[model samples]
Target chain A: MWRRRQDPDRAAPEAALGAILAAVLAILALIGPAPAWAAETAAAKEPAGAAPAEPMHVIVGYLGQEEVPRQPLSFLEPELQDEGVQGARLGIADTNTTGRFLNQRFDLVEAVIPRNTDPAVAIAAQMQALADKGVRLLVADLPAERLVQALDQPAAGGMLVLNARAPDDNLRNEACRPNLLHTIPSRRMLADALAQYLVWKRWTRWMLVAGRYPEDLAYAEALRRAARKFGAKIVEQKSWTFEEGNRRADSGHTTVQSLVPTMTQGADHDVLVVADERDIFGEYLPFRTAEPRLVAGTQGLVPTNWSRVHEQWGATQLHSRFEKLAGRWMTPRDHAAWVAVRAVGEAATRTRSADPEQLSRFITGPDFTLAAFKGQALSFRPWDGQLRQPVLLAGPRMLVSVSPQDGFLHRVTTLDTLGDDQSDSRCTRQ
Target chain B: MGRMRAGLAVALGVLTILPGGGAAAYSVYVSNERSNTVAVVDPETLTVSKTIPVGRRPRGITFSHDYKHLYVCVGDDDRVDVIDTASGTVVDSLPSGPDPELFVLHPQKPVLYIANEDDNMVTVVDTQTRRVLGEIQVGVEPEGMGISPDGTVLVNTSETTNMAHFIDTTSLQITDNVLVDSRPRVAQFTPDGRHVWVSSEIGGTVSVIDMQTRQVVHKIGFEVRGVPKEAIQAVGIELTADGSTAFVALGPSNRVAEVDQKTYAVRRYHLVGQRVWNLALSPDGKRLYTTNGVSNDVSVIDVAAGKVIKSLPVGDSPWGVAVKP
Candidate 1:
């Protein structure tokens, strides 16, 4: 049997000693010229005083909508219940854990709009309400345009807004806001990560297939830029016009098997790269491609922020903890939201300040670094406030690789090799 | 200087008296995290002497105060496996709370402080009775454990919390918390007890905190030419007896940075195996052993030579290393 220490009285003397030392240092500072170390020691001892100060309150608003529509794919792709919110919830829990030690308190005010409602009006109203409630740190899970609208709202003025869902390149470029920090990796970054890996493997020739959606075209455009940057060749390109039918129907498999081969028939390339951000037809081309080639991009071997199969760098513990909490594997949105909130926790703990402006300054300063279970410390690019992280190349069941591959060099960091660097930045904000 | 000389003299006397102890006969015990085994390597021959099987996911290893038993944190088993050094077999086990990752023993007392990573607590156990004494609530995901030279303070670095919690030994309560860079993985007290060096694996820097003020006086970062900044992740730290030179294992970069303690400057980078996680210095302070996780090898570094002398193949994903005193 273990004897547990139940008496809190044992801590009283230590606290009392701390208080006395603080008082002595305070007196020494007031009386005569004290050494620099004395002032520093006094500041360090403030947290140990007998009477614990009131915990500094930091309220963050989770602004988003529930039940967003998904692509009509396999029945195995279940509707996500707590996609972005659960990540913020876990982030709050993580923040509270560190907050407890720092005499700080973190609270999340959720303002989720209904799926059927007008998102812009509902989001604006929620932002106003959150501002009324003194919520200054906001995690926006809205689309790129709606996120921009929310950022432009007067209620969001002076607030630090973290974009957790939007991965639009314009968010980190020409339309980037001074107060908004982007946690999601842009399409360009994802494309570059995949391109680097493919180039490293010498799979330089690509047969590009794109879905007939604006998002899909944008992703294809990014991939095209990456191919040009990394010296890869796009041997052929084609757009898919076939509408996705009921994926679970009996004839669905046969239809996909016949349609994909016809769509990929004219291409002779090393790899078949599909750009289908909506997941409409990318999964169909993997095993049914014409040339029996390796498939990559938005489906087959995809680039993502977080994967259920990633269990390296102590991510196994995080994965298991999330499973225990949410009863499911963590998604990329969850990881982004978690990173956003954890950034707040880290800044507050380091600066020992709860002021929103001070926190924002500290977060953007050179000292800010966040550990998001990615094996490396992640920091925001000062120019665009985009979190720089390694993109994971994952297959269906395993992590294929992490890119910014071995030889991809950058003056700042290898991570810069993935995203927009200082030289390429359209963001004018310092 | 006199105290250090006396300590060296005592170490020499122990080496002469102990059966397995000698200047050139020290053994290095490395825990292979993924393989669930401990590889025992002889320093003189630079070869693995024996492979001892242990529980699942064994990490963070150290020797008992009397040097009679080796304590290994079998993380998946949620207990500490005590191995008798003479037989190189498990003799007993201690209740080390849930998900024990790393631990430290009080220099003069029989108390063992174990960092329970998942439970967010440090379990203190009595080695003589194999019974837990008390549990101290700490930051989340605590991994690193370091004790002051006098055993008055115990430092535990929480991975996710990113702070080093300093616990008073007598009160068993947190006395101070120093925020380091992100994902602090290991902490070590300088031999002179003036500072505590903490390595932040994700932040890619080592924070040297002043012991008296409990403040980070210097944040030492590495810059290996041609190696990306993110790859220079400082994880394991080993300080010399004189506290003049420090060696830091840069994870994933496959290099160990030798730093000057006083100036906090990296003097040289020695190429090692992939993903070097932990390091151990010999009792005589002549050789350093590094456990490289990805390459599955132990890099033997000659301290005076400031370079890797040899790489000995070990089990898969070798993580923590402990040297026989």
Candidate 2:
């Protein structure tokens, strides 16, 4: 230690300094092993982030190809299905580019089922093949029951099944499996988020329009639950069928008006919330509402995984990467698939190894977190497979606003208030 | 520079000034990179007192000029969180630029220079006001900044550009650009302020820059047969008072290389815990504290013998190390 003797109070070290040096060495020599009684677990120590190491492999398992045989009971048209699959492919490529730093490798593989055939068998076979190929993580964008049947294999213990397509609330809540994760927020979650936002905005009264389909009814039921939860009232309810389409011509506007009620119904609600999860007849209600009520569901105000018109703080980068890779923009389903893989990757980083049990625990742990394009950090629901995240509530042209505007005070953002939080959640058996 | 610990460890002197036995005197600080928690430990008793939680992603911690406050740059949280030495609580978060990764405090003033990795800027914050007094543009991902002994010149390490920007302290402008290895980080000056050793993680070596000449005098590579220079990924480097020896932590290889500062040669390559990222030597220069990132362990080495005496498990992805001993 040098003191240039420029300062008035400066002086050389006395004999006490020499004694300190001798004591310091003596302390270093008296070392001991760690007593393994830490306050926090090693895995949950850091904020959840994907590991820098590359994944073992990426397996994109399709159910089966149409070239095989006859078609299934229900599916979107071939062009629509192709569009969805195209969305998935682009998402895979986008993840690869974004995660290129970690040397994350990706592969897109597919299989198709025949007419009237059960998609479950083919999906299970593909999942088994995925296991053999050392892919312990998966992204399945299939329907509800079929996805469940596909993941029913006992050997699928190590594989993390991510539901990319299925939006059935049961998949995220009651029927949620150990390794099975859901990227698609449940319909209940979306409805709750929207209802919370509406309630916060003081749009308390609702003009409810229910659809004929089961999924539609389920969505309506979810909205009803939300209305009850958030002190909103459903003032009126209306149901319609796909009727008199060809009969109503341009010249017969009077006839169409007579059949569909041109005058005011007995509705005293502020918002006309349509619960048509399917694109059946609710598409016609937006511009056709008699009174000036806010149309939702199929049009106007809609809650989805991700929207194309979204151009927020970090959306452009994700959208650009997705388009450049797959040569097309990502769909809502594609975003779900991507989030699933990223979640698994983050779990691997936390646990430091690809043990399924450890990764599962790491994810469900209280500290498990993953940052998405939603501009906030989200964690998983320990009781269920649901990833409690902000639902992107949007309109046709632009995003009106994100929900959970009030009462949500996360370390990051208030949007986290939309989805199922720990207290109001019913997933106790997970 | 092990003996550099003897002179620059002003915090350890404060601890030794207390009336305590030999075993309970030294204080150990573990910088948890991800959790942003600094674990304070009593080295002799091996007892962790409290995990002082700070801002988001706290890394690169150092005591103040008078060794009163432990200044930690909370990276993602965009603040230089200050810890009150006596209470060890985060009393204040210094307003900083986005992603303040590493920092250097001026020895005589209240100015704290924070390296903003994202915006490629060096924000000079008035620590007392916790306000940004001045800012200057630097290269991409400015990871480290160092101040001269007299506090006249400031050297900023631009990680991507692999160069050190020497700034005139009073003017706060870049006066010189001294090019070093690829991914130059942790630009630390020698104890006597004669030379600056810039650690290049990917280059697998430390470049010694002569301050007076403002040029790299020599590039010292870690000598090993099977280990490539890239594998070394030398991150954090420290030196002794006489500038006789220096220790460089190789992140990829999980080892520390002790190099002869004058000869520009590695004296010994000591095996440490897994993925050693940073280091801190005891005040008496007898013990060395290392943050093993991957293994989440801290390797306490006997500096005189140059061997690991204890490997204490800390938090997940442990990174920075500061010793009060």
Candidate 3:
């Protein structure tokens, strides 16, 4: 269910202030003139020598779907408690910590649509309500299609939305919106991060195994492009046709043990790269591969936006704080949501404005820099509104490396090497 | 046997004479973050003379007012280890609140202001008594500490909060808070103390804040040809005694920007080791030292020539650098 007011205690003071203001205005009208009491009240509102501190209000809306129970293939990976919402909540709290000193207050409103409802219609209505409430900033955790629908809504015309979940590259390319900024790393970026590390390690030969899902194929396609860009060779490509078995079943291990070995029998490459975006059977292929090759891409040694094991560059503090708040490890989705909310906070703090247009301009401008605990400053690309950041290459227990590797340089920034650069961007947003 | 005894006497005489010699005998102390040790480097030879074991995760290092002790921030231990300069051993520990990453000592007073990154507060301690005096609430994740030359105002830069809080020394109250760019890592006041130079590690710029106006009067940016803009993260800043030139450590870019302080223009860039985080100037102001985190070495730069004269391998992940005159 949508938790309309995530924090009611925070809203009480503002509501009380509004009530007092209304009462004062009513009294002034009843007096019908600039009476002595009204004058005294006005003077009392202003301190003798100090100016009245008026806190700036910035409301950010979170749009996503109601959580549905997921049956994870492995018991080691439990269901997330709040996923994107918790990260947004943490972001709001972090912003408020800074906001207290800056005379600014950050608030987040949540709108979670049920699974049965049509997301497009529900999102349009939600956007209308948010717009009515003067909310111009949003963190959209929806898929690409629904996000586009939300963006196209007339109520959202003046809003600045941060895409926190969807990694669809088309959203940054052909379907790019001028008002939309993407915080999530695209598939190509993730693929290129892995490819660069593999190339640096001299593991240039890859055996690709793609699942049957379209998303899986899309990931495979991105990996192919990355391999070509980074001078890697895909020795062979095969599609996985085995049905996913229940991990809790008694015969599951037997099936996985035989299936994975046969599926990876022909690959004699340096690494076995799997593209199972749907999480069908990638986990089973890690240790049961035919050869003694290392596993990468989507599982095994993965390139991610965030990892629980990464502790370098002051990320240990972030990891501990998130664990304290969420009571669980921070996922990549949570990191994206945190980045999105921090972006708005950073923009408002720097530009000293609550206007959506001004904040948008500042975030896209050259002067804006976001310290996202990524060991570098992250900024959005003007052409596509994709936030440029270094991708972390991590194993299950430790951080292996960070990409946009040393030799992989770009004309603007090394971060531009991870994703679609400006010259390659097809986005026409002005 | 007589010749060998004569040689040993000559070596002992040379060692005694070196300590009495002027600035050439000064030692540069570097804190190795991962190795939990401090490497004492000889500036003249550009080599580590001795390695002293320290507390866990030693990051920021500074000398006491009298230069008798070196205070090192052991972030994991939540205390500052006081090292006796004469013996190069941990003599005592100061109860610096939680996760103290950086600290500054007042020029005239015996008070030490430590930035507790996890606590979001500045812990003030009496350097003489090693007792906690008070803690002033500041912005989140404070990582940088600086004090005015006159010791009237204390400045702390919070990395996540993105603000520099100015605290009045007498009252220990925050008088003003100025917003800087993202992740400001180091703050240093010029010799004259008219302006405070804050380096924003993630912002890739240096903000020079006027002391009187409490406003950023100038922001110095860097542009290295063939280097990515994001890689040019400005971290440590050091100004010469004459205030004519400033050296800035560009993190991950493997270079130090030499800027003309009067013109605020980058005069040249001296190549250094990987992921240079902090810098220290020699006693004579002729040699500048940079702690390279990734390369596990220190690069000694010649101030007049603006070149890295030599790179000496130190401990693992050397982060903070200080010089004992």
Candidate 4:
């Protein structure tokens, strides 16, 4: 019913505070008795169906793989087998909570490919099978290559795929696909979120340390781009060549304590920025930096899609609900998957349709916004199909801040300042 | 000009400190979520006259029907702290369900309808007997409680469920469930009880639902220049007694929108403080008070003047506001 209007004219600036405390003594003189709670009355209860109707079933397919789990650097941070799927499950529950009133029932059909198999072949067969089940909506938790292969299937051309796992920037840029929408925050977005906060805090000099993996290098490249974009200077860059050890071993701290300071000794920088996406050495960089410099990016203070410590914007309730359902803290992948499933739910609820075409159009349309517990309404970019949302800069046990920071303004939404902007985007698809 | 403004401030300050002999004096209570305290603001002086210490994470606040006791939702403590208005201290506590967020009172009865965020149910408590009458199951994360003017129909909105549920008072049954936008924070019924305006914090729109038909008649959107649409989140809504004008708190945009009630059009925006979370109107409806979460302050707006008069610093993370005459 509401329509967008032309932007209102700007108003005058704010005025100053002039009033002072006049009478401090007059505040505490009054006293009154509390009310007596004596009267009691019984009320009868009757159960009635709020909305009684035959529910329409909407099926959503989840395509993922049972990947060989990698042990995390810390014992507290365990690699979850049901990470992405748990979130999708929670999303289905949440969707059905709203869908019940609308007479729309949502069912998630999960097909996780077995380990040590050809992912493309498995994805193709799974896509065909899901398509046969009349499941047009899909939440893909696959990696970049597998996700692309899954969507490249002939049957997937009609299916709307929500990419929930891949954080690779290429998927949101040169390799962007019209049918595939990404809910995961790209590497560039994560880097830019941290960069904005660092620049806002006036920590402009960065000591960049990266691992040898391709994902690490890609994240490091994004950090470099963010530094250039946000007016920060990368004072020095280093490659970590140390082999990982048993994370829970008692001797691990001594080695980390010695090697980290040695690797970070002589950089005249304000912060040590780590790009160890494989979780090799980033967690050890903090408190062991050469000059008491703050460590961020991938560890210490991390720019992430979601964190366990984030409780703002009514996220505490969400976090509580997820913990009750998943029995673990939600990771970034879980949050993305949840948003992906919830986006479908939101689109379905708004459009009142289960048709994949209608839901996809409504989701990518200008008016479609997902309230994903981020204090902002998140929506996908028309140019790149990337979800634009505020990235949380989180410490290990608490949320530090969220970016785009206060003054980083954008022509469109401020969330566009984090990732590939319209002008910087390489994707031509709308 | 600076000297003249100082002189006027001193004169206004002196006038407020004196006891009101004939004219009615009102006290504005602001719940500081982070501070776990309530700021007792003097409406006349536009200053925090007293600070009442309460339980942890106090959020939703309101006065009893007789305006003698103030009920503050202490979420961490899982109870409602009752503050004696005259003494400015917490004197008693009520057994509210776990993580009580927001609540409402029946117009002509000593009954409290509380939104228990953790339980996904509305806990109905008898105010006079301090006993929970019943718990009505609603959608997930139930908040935004509203009772009709005639105190017959009760409405509760669930943040995640995105539905404003209409409940029958006598039978305690859900009569109708009207789906609105995402994260509906507050449901404010028009004084005449013809419609209910529900503010969706993440949806960035206020859904105006016709009470008779239980359908959304209109959706009101707000826009302010130099501010992003995400920041212009619709949160708390305050409608005038005559229902001619409605003021909506735009969260994180630091603005309050003046809207035309009949047309469902945003008239203009008055810049307030950062993350305006909720609103309260003075008894006379001539002034509006907004609790700004991030800034830890309260912005006072002169309703008829269409401008913010002052920003008074309060405790940390001011979440809710209530006014007592």
Candidate 5:
């Protein structure tokens, strides 16, 4: 019954320490004292048939979401796979209960399309087969385009798709579709979150370092939009090219310091930002630079989906519980996956049925609110159908700051204001 | 200002430490798994009095016989922090075996037995001098350990071993080992000493051990995915003084179950919060509190009503719940 209030007034602490403490207390309050209103609502609404059976039935279908791993020479590292299918499996246990409430039973059965498979055709076949088997909710971790294609098919049937990936801003804007509830926050929102923190720290002037990779450049473009949208100024812009395994003196480090001369030349400005999504040179810019700069993005002050070590705000407990259940630390996308299932649970609690129309209505209703494990209340944008959330701006070891930093103070802060909120949406599906 | 902070910490220490000497009031303290502090609260007043810092990763808690000291199980630190009742400072530490969790102190004896969750053993310590008495190997993942009223018997619950280990305190040996349930934790003996109650968190069942026969005579089951249920993973366990009722905390299901001790059947299931770990009941047995680790609050359940009346907020990652002296 403990529910996150959609109150716009809730905020982070004065500084870093204060932020952690407040987040812990705020999250504790949400999980601790669930008002009778939520319990009464769940009891009054959930379909009696959702309750557990002896055998414990659950149905799970994969959206075949990964971008084909591109060159197949991807690192056999833990974090990559850690973020994908492995994280999606948690939806099984999560689909049964939302926020520790287990009114429903999950009998999980998986329908997966192998990598390199066409999600449009393959997912449609899987969705049809699953729908006939009484599975009403689909956890679609696919890209924005594949998601639309998968949803458009009459063969795909009328199942509500729980969006788990594709963090593009356009998806929740002009591309927003009905019955598609995203768990991924758009890059615009995430950048704005980072921008809010910088502005709050009075680091108004920024030096931008763009990565050579295409995706990195796109992220840099988002940062540019965010910088201009906020009051901050990007004083200088520079680009860094990566030669694999090269750590040259004139690599990213010199290029970043070279920009510092012009960006802060005889002028007072804080923060040096880097946009390196390819994971090549971003890890080297911090502390290696000449000045004592507060580096951000793929470097000193990067924003991540989630970190295993962030326990300051009761996140350790969340990590431990997830590790205890899944036998591993939680990843970034798992947050999205967990949110998807939790949204389904919330919708199920409200509508009392797994029926597609009723559940989708319950989820998309203006009054609908979901807890996204980030100590915040999460809801969908009617425009491109992206999930609106505050991104966790993190460093390698400690949290630099949370985005949507204090003092930007809109009804929902400039963080929510940046992404597609209720005011700026085009599709209006919500 | 620093002096005042220290004075307040001292006064708070005295209030929570001293037995009937401090005040005629009730408060709750919970140990967080992640944070290095204990959340203190005045339960009756419903206020968070203070969050006193402590050693690393504290989990279980128990008070001294005369309530002169409060012992906290700091699992990662590998020691039990003893808080002096008068000063409210961690005066000393007891050497508990590795990864100590969940404690049960003998009322009269100077002995404190701890279930070492990781080392798969029970650490018996002398509370008077704050020293390790000896260690006794029991089962894998020893979680909950409790001593009998007579101070002669100690029961340890093993999570993966699926057994309740009975130890002879005088001899410091595991005299009898009887199998129970999967993930057996939080073992306690009946008040009158007729039977012992063991809760299998993941097993979702409570096994009753007959004291005389030394066997699991009765098995208490839960209707809601009892131990075998994929969703409901139970952890915390406690029993009333009269031995007529018991309570079990379920983690993911976020519910507390009331079991009729006589019939070994669940009478009620009250929803609470996620990842609940430890349990504590008032000496009068009217109110029960459980530490919800994930939710970061203590579930204050009205035992008679079989409902969670309120939840008391605590520090980050609250995992162990204990009542102040």
Candidate 6:
């Protein structure tokens, strides 16, 4: 079932827009020589003067392209069926809360493409259908390549799509699209955030351990770039191969305990950075390291856009709200989707318009900022359309630190130093 | 017991005034969020006279009409602990809705309006009867309660909703809603009740709304020379009684901005301890006390000189401050 609900009782007040005095006069004139209770009931039923304003409807579509469900190594983590869409639903609810007072209502239309289908064709069809329904705002929870294909669709040309899933660097760098704005932080941004924290703590030497997956290699490359940008040195590097075994079966720790330490034995470094983006061996490398070095990068002490351990700067308020709605802790993807939908809502509220062009222009232009419990105002970067925000460095049970650390300065904002700055960006969008 | 505590406080005040010391006319109470205690400080001695333990995660604090009881919003416990001001101890608990963050007492009545952040509603309670009056549905994360000087209109700013809701006190109905910047933390009315200044923390701006029209008339922004714009978050706002000057606490910027009320210009920035959260001014309007959240201390300011005179250490993470005159 869809999460959209229409409240019939939320009619716009007749006395809105400085018409209280006129409404009072009209009420008195309508119920002349009537009993007080009758007068009160008549006034409560409907104002006697002006017709009530019709609430404006702003509809946003959510397009989720199917992918293979990821299986976690441990049983504690399960595959989430509705990660991004739940966040969009919460976003709609939050926006409707504010929209009720402004005589505006928000609705979210969700559609998911089945797995093993031609994603390009599915994306185009979804876009055409959504556009036919007058949904000019969309949240795309697709891969980097499919996202580009979706934007290239004729129907999507007139729509504004917020990228809530993919975080590939090239999508933001050389292959940027004009209609796409990213809410998820890029891999390079996460690497830079972690590197800054490690460098600030004087942990300059790192042992880079990468996985065989393409995403893992991409993340490893980002870590290398971050090390070069900051002052950290990669003392050694290793590539891990898949070992077929049930990680949660009986006596599973014995296998991982021996393999991880042997794999980490040859490095002389202050920290071990794992590039296992998939639910792989990264979670097993923390306490099983040869040296007692802290594990970071994709697991252990990791840099993330959102975490359950974060509670400062009114984060508990958002965490509780999301938990109440979704019945689970808010994930990074959920937060990404939430911010994407909220960005559209915030733009509509501030600009007081439902037109996609005007809202998109205001969002990309100067003077547009959104606050999503990050302790700072977030805005889209001019060059790449990447969001500028602080990344949380979190352990499993506690928030260790926040990046864009102290002493890291920039000409404009310290947040710009984490992601690709405009000067070094290769994006052609203006 | 009340007379005994007052006598002891007077005797200690006399002892503290032996060496060119002027006895303070008020006592300062600060809620420590991390320590779950309220630190009571003597303004004259510039030291904590006593520390009273309360419920977990004490944040918003206020006083009763007669100043006989102090109410602390124990957020984690979902209740308000009432501290007997005379004894400097918690005496009772008021049944509040879920996660009450901030609240305001009616100026001339026994009604207390509490913002239930978790429930997205405002819980109205009669302090004298200790009974629930009504619950008004509000925006998301309702915070920053402010009442007009005449006590006819109440303004509650919801942080996530990004709107300042104006409620009619008599009918308990929302009259008007004014959209503001993001994460509005505090709302303070002018002395003459002509305007309400709402501080938006993440938006880093203060919006001044005309009370009559319920529209934003002017917006005030803050900028520190070396500090980044994101760090200059506006949280607590204190306006002078004469309505000429306003002091705003800049969270994490470690500075308090002094604004010219008439022109809406930031005149100067006063550097204080780390993460200055909430502020309270003395009754005579001469001294200002700031609760530094990160530094676990309170910075005392000389309003005339516009400089920090002293910083007295307190419990961990002092959140809200109130002065009893």
Which candidate ranks first by lDDT, i.e. highest? 6
Q: Write the per-residue lDDT of candidate 1 for residues A1-430, one digit (tens) a residue.
A: 1011233222111011011122222312323332232233224333465588788998878988766567447566766768888899889988898888778999999988777888778777888998998888889988887788888888877587899999899889999877778898999999999998999899999999999988898899999999988889999999999876755677668777788888898746999999998877788887798888999999999999999989888787777777777888889999999899999888777777677665666576665678888888788887788898999999999999998787665545668778788778898655
lDDT of 5 by residue, B1-325 (tens): 0011111122121223335544434556677767878777665455567776778888788778777778899977888988775566788888888777788887578888888775657888887776788887665557778778788888887654456777888888766666554456678787778888887664556777887767667767665522213235556777777667777787656788888877877788877777677777765566678888878888777666667767867777788776764
Instruction: Please give the DockQ score of every candidate, comma-separated.
Output: 0.23, 0.02, 0.21, 0.22, 0.05, 0.23
The reply for model 1, stretches above 4 Å from the true place, is A1-46, A69-72, B1-24, B262-266
lDDT for position A361 in model 1: 62
lDDT of 3 by residue, A11-57 (tens): 11101101112222231232222223212211211111255477888
- Between prediction 1 and prediction 4, which has the larger lDDT? 4
Off by over 4 Å in 5: A1-58, A66-79, A94-103, A107-134, A155-157, A212-214, A240-269, A287-292, A321-329, A345-358, A366-372, A381-385, A412-418, B1-55, B59-69, B73-325
TM-score for chain A, prediction 2: 0.74
lDDT-better candidate, 4 vs 6: 6
Worst 10 residues of 6 chain A by lDDT: A13-22
TM-score of chain B of 6: 0.93
Q: For residues B111-171, could you state the per-residue lDDT of candidate 6 as single tens digits? A: 8899998888999988878898999999889999999988999999999888888898988
Candidate 2 vs candidate 6: the TM-score winner is 6
Question: Which residues of candidate 6, in runs, are more than 4 Å off?
Answer: A1-51, B1-23
In model 4, the runs with Cα more than 4 Å from the true position are A1-51, B1-24
Q: Candidate 4 residues B1-325, lDDT tens each?
A: 0011121122212343444442336678999999999999976667788999999999999889888999999999999999999798999999999999999999999899999998889999998899999999898899999989999999999998878889888989888887787889999899889999999988888988888777777788777766766677899888877768888999988999999988988888989999998998777676789999988999988776777778999899999899886
Which candidate has the top score in TM-score? 6
Model 6 TM-score, 2 decimals: 0.90
Compared with the true structure, what per-residue lDDT tens digits does model 1 show for residues B107-188? 9998889999887899999988988889999887898999999999999999998889999999998988888777888999
In candidate 5, what are the lDDT values of residues A148-190, reduced to their tens digit?
7777777444556777777766666677555566786666676
Candidate 2 chain A: worst-modelled 10 consecutive residues by lDDT: A14-23
lDDT of candidate 4 over A1-430, digit per residue (tens): 1012333442312122111111111111213321111110001111145435567678898988888786788678877789799899999998998786667899999988777778777877888988898877899999888888887888786677899999999998888876778999999999999998998899999999999999999999999999998889999999998877767676668778888888998769999999988787788888888799889998889999999899988899888989999899888888999999999998777766676665666676666778888988888777788998999999988899998887776555668788888778898565
Deviating ranges (above 4 Å) for candidate 3: A1-50, A118-121, B1-24
Could you give candidate 2's per-residue lDDT for residues A112-162 as a string of tens digits?
A: 444455556665666677667656556776778767777687546555566
lDDT (Cα atoms) of all candidates against the true structure? 0.82, 0.65, 0.81, 0.82, 0.63, 0.83
Ordered list by lDDT, greatest first: 6, 4, 1, 3, 2, 5
